[model samples]
Target: MRSAVVAALALGLLGACSAGTEPQTGDPAQATAAETPTMLASAPVDLAAAEPPECLSDGIAYATVGQDAGATTVAWAGAGDRGVLFAPQENGDVCQWSAEVARLAGAGYLVATYDWGASGQAGFQAALDVLKATGADRVAFVGASAGGTLAAGLADDLSAVAVVALSPPAQYGDVDARVEANQFTGPLQVFSSTDDPQVPAADSALVVRNDKTSIVTEVSGTAHGIEFMAPDGYHAEHVRGTIDTALSQGFGEG
Candidate 1:
């Protein structure tokens, strides 16, 4: 577990404190044709020229897209042509500073996160569109909570390099992760804690595809969503290790 101060700060923007701030609008993907292309023209942030805030990790360049759609932020690190899209928990904004997201950026992979604008699948699809347009040789998905369910449900359509879902439910609205998981053949990593109150370990297990490449890591702590990947939070290293391993093994393999 993180220290009291760290835990409080992390939780502040994750969900508990981020209500009503999220935009309630139509899907950004459905924006005007002119707006869609502009959002996809992602440019890299020059980290060496400008200093990143203390909240964001060093070595990673930052950028944004989908402002017209719903504001999608992207962080890039390393030299790999592969990219990873990170989806936050329910009610969490993609623009918020997150150490876990920063770490993924630092690992030398192109990373993207975005606001869904309450458009559900459309919002998620919009984020994926931006990632694919960036010219990345390969791409993957990582999400927590509601974002996790979305990732699992759309993995097949996205043709993701792999997927890593933390504390996710088996379904989100009409999207069933279990049904979608059965069709995905890539490496899938699902993390769950037996102590999580919001999502039971059993519910998380419902996503298991029972394939040789699928893995469900059950831990003892109660951290859910992005907290599960916080450096100072419980199961942080495990989350990082899983992503690192999956990216190395699955990224750009095709």
Candidate 2:
């Protein structure tokens, strides 16, 4: 029973390319889970079927994107002198983050979305790994709940990219401290639905900026998971439009 469990766990930990740099995140490989070996000689994660589609983004030809190490499948799009990456909800495997990816990718930027932790449940150090692996000097983090945690954590690493959060939970262990202590001088966008009770609207209230930060964007809606779970027929459209505006402006300068 132990051996079987270990094997299953080992297969899971084979992902997540690097360790977390957060003071609270000690040896991200040790963050959580049943303790599995990470650096194995086994072949890279087989995610060939999940390669980013070769789609045209705003008339630009962008190569399909996928991480070689950690073997994460990122649905990347767009091409330009610089790169832009889009992280999925926590692990980047779910279909919910697809619309967000499309918005970023279609805007003539190199956007990438991938899985982190294991599946979508565990994602403490994923943001840093994804940004590092993609070589995206500029990035934008988007997600709800745990996925939102990943975005806030990476705000320091990709200090250059615009960081956006929608209905991000308030209690995230020490990760919250990192956001508080760090300087997000770039474009920062945060939105919390006024109707959601599970997460605090105060998350949208906390804004950190330095001399360089030119914009702090905060929007409010009446739904949960605006990017995905919103039930209204136009909810997805609202998310799509909001994303379009955010990415359009956020990706341009800040």
- Per-candidate TM equals 0.69, 0.56
C-alpha-based local distance difference test score of model 1: 0.60
Per-model CA lDDT versus the true structure: 0.60, 0.43
- In model 2, the runs with Cα more than 4 Å from the true position are 1-73, 90-92, 116-135, 177-179, 207-222, 226-242, 248-254
Looking at model 1, residue 109 earns an lDDT score of: 50
lDDT of 1 at 239: 81
Model 2 lDDT on a 0 to 1 scale: 0.43
Cα lDDT tens digits for candidate 2, 168-246: 6643545561346555555555555665665656664453342333232334555444343443544455445555555
